[model samples]
Target: MLVSLTREKFEQIIPLIATGAQYAYYWGKWQDLLNRLLISVVAVVVILILDVVLGQGAQALILLLGVIAGLYWLWSPIYWASLRNNQYRRFPYSGFWRGRILEIFLTEDLIGEEETVNQRGDLVINEIRERRINLVIGDETGFEIELQAPLQRLYKAIAPGQIAELLVLSRQPNLAKIDKFTDAYIPSLNLWIGEYPYLQRDVFAEVSRQLGSDRSRANLNKNRVRKPPMK
Candidate 1:
């Protein structure tokens, strides 16, 4: 069936998106190490094959390849280490994979309903059913982060107050700060609502339809606007 969606319906499933920096922080470590190891291993295997194909110059070729591979092996870890170190300094409360710092909780300790206006002109309301923790970078975007499961070691580096400061980057956009929220699993972070949008699809759709098509179109048009000309 070709399902058609009302604008309201589409907004309901607007999946939360993560920022690129957080994305890199979450998955970069293991992938970087694996890639470096793969490159070094492949270089060695290729050198061995070259040695077999050209018997006389095989050893010399292997030696040269070995030198290059050794250089890569030495440099890759240092490079990766430096990059990770820098990222940690910027987002100490954020999670990482390569190092011993296990998990960083972004949100903590809140109950009941929460609402805040977002930068994108959308209102976000989070109903804190229970104590829950979601990692987030300190930015106006209020982007939420998800870390790899099975977090081993916990970092006691950045205090809870510091993380709160990063998330509330600006005073504008009607950001709502919820205090005393606690997450049992990860009890270090604070909970804040940056922006969450609500839709009429859930219970209002039927009611709005009864009101008439004119009302429906008006509701739909309110949320949509004409795009500006590219030229």
Candidate 2:
């Protein structure tokens, strides 16, 4: 009888749970694009060869198939790469769009190290720190906005166990840039929201048995605790 209720509970909160998982998954995915790039390149070449071998009449069809596959493989890494590299292509934020809804987790509790900054001319930009920021989000992609901005001050002042909420703006992307910080990107499911609450090494081990979020099931299992998992 308890099992039935447990399943029901999982179902009821599945949306939120899925959101957390997605964030966790994509966050890593954004970093995995490098490994996948070579594969994507090979796939494109193979598709082109097959299209030519099949015949000219089917050239358009094969080309279409190749393009679709190429796009599917490239979108995430491309998007993340573009965003990370482009200073102007900042993550979309509430001020940029309106009416869009989102959930935010205050991971200040999971603080790592303080980020340093240098004044270049007059702009205040981060000087690349050794800490990892755990910012997760759940979004209905169809909404007008493309990039959802991080809650800046809150993220800066995050503490353990702090959770918050915010509304996002509605806007469409006219152009986007690649991120230079990361080397690759991957795609993820929509269940990372709840998973993150336990991803902290201290928290993960303590609640592993309770949440079934053990290393065996984690999408990110390389890290043991303080150190980052292999990138």
Candidate 3:
């Protein structure tokens, strides 16, 4: 199920690049939002105290804090956009691969750890766990991969036997070796599952639809050609 991506076809994805970038802008590193807020609050209080006592040096340090905050918030969108284009150039050749959903379930994964005190007032790092969607997908070649995604309405409806389209990376023009992969796109749900926003959903949907239709036609033709009786 490796469909080649041509230059002309790839160009269609250009118009939709901004969509992915925008998505990255808003939702990127969302898990760290609380920590960022706490840090900013603490930094502001420190700067205010220092400014009153040591005006000149505090002003310079305060300016640096602003720069750091801006970078932290903006790096996701900027980096993702650049990487998207770089991937296209570096891997000029591309292919489309898909797998069948063998199983779908939910699991609570340890997402982070935070320092906290217990009833006895002891300092300890507490585990932060969150429910995530887990998937087991198998390709026609019998290669299976396990993937996890944030639990959302988009992933809740996944069922066995549905197709799981994957975005894999490889240097070979034919995708001879799929050593790394990015995300899983479920055409049936019109949703993507992964930690990163990597695809232009519109283009992915269009391409998936076309591929689905083409495969259906091919399968129909194959079925029409009856096999001869075994001697």
* The 10-residue segment with the lowest total lDDT in model 1: 91-100
* TM-score of decoy 3: 0.67
What tens digits encode model 3's per-residue C-alpha lDDT throughout 1-231? 667677556555433344644445454475656555666567666666766887786677767765565455445455456556565545555666788999988899999899999999999998999999888999788878898877887565789998888666567777777665657788777767876555666776788889899999999998897779999
lDDT of 2 by residue, 1-231 (tens): 001112222223222222333334444654366555666678788888897788787878887877766765545534443333233223331111112223333322332344545665554534332223343323344332222222343334433223222221112323132121111011111111222221222222223233334435563656546767888
Q: Higher-lDDT candidate among 1 and 3?
A: 3
Q: How accurate locally is residue 165 in candidate 1, as Cα lDDT from 0 to 100?
A: 18
- What TM-score, computed on C-alpha atoms, does each candidate reach? 0.25, 0.28, 0.67
Candidate ranking under lDDT, highest first, comes to 3, 1, 2
Worst 10 residues of 3 by lDDT: 13-22
Ranking by TM-score: 3, 2, 1
Off by over 4 Å in 2: 1-9, 15-31, 74-231
Between the candidate structures 1 and 3, which one is better when assessed by TM-score? 3
Instruction: Give Cα distance to truth, residue 204, candidate 1, Å.
Output: 52
Off by over 4 Å in 3: 7-93, 118-121, 220-231
lDDT of 1 by residue, 1-231 (tens): 012233343323221232232333333576666776788888888877877888885687679887788567446544443454343223212111011122346444444687888899799997764434344323334433332222223433333333331111112222232211111122133221222211112222332234345556878999998999999
Would you give me the overall lDDT of model 2? 0.35
Local distance difference test scores for all models: 0.39, 0.35, 0.70
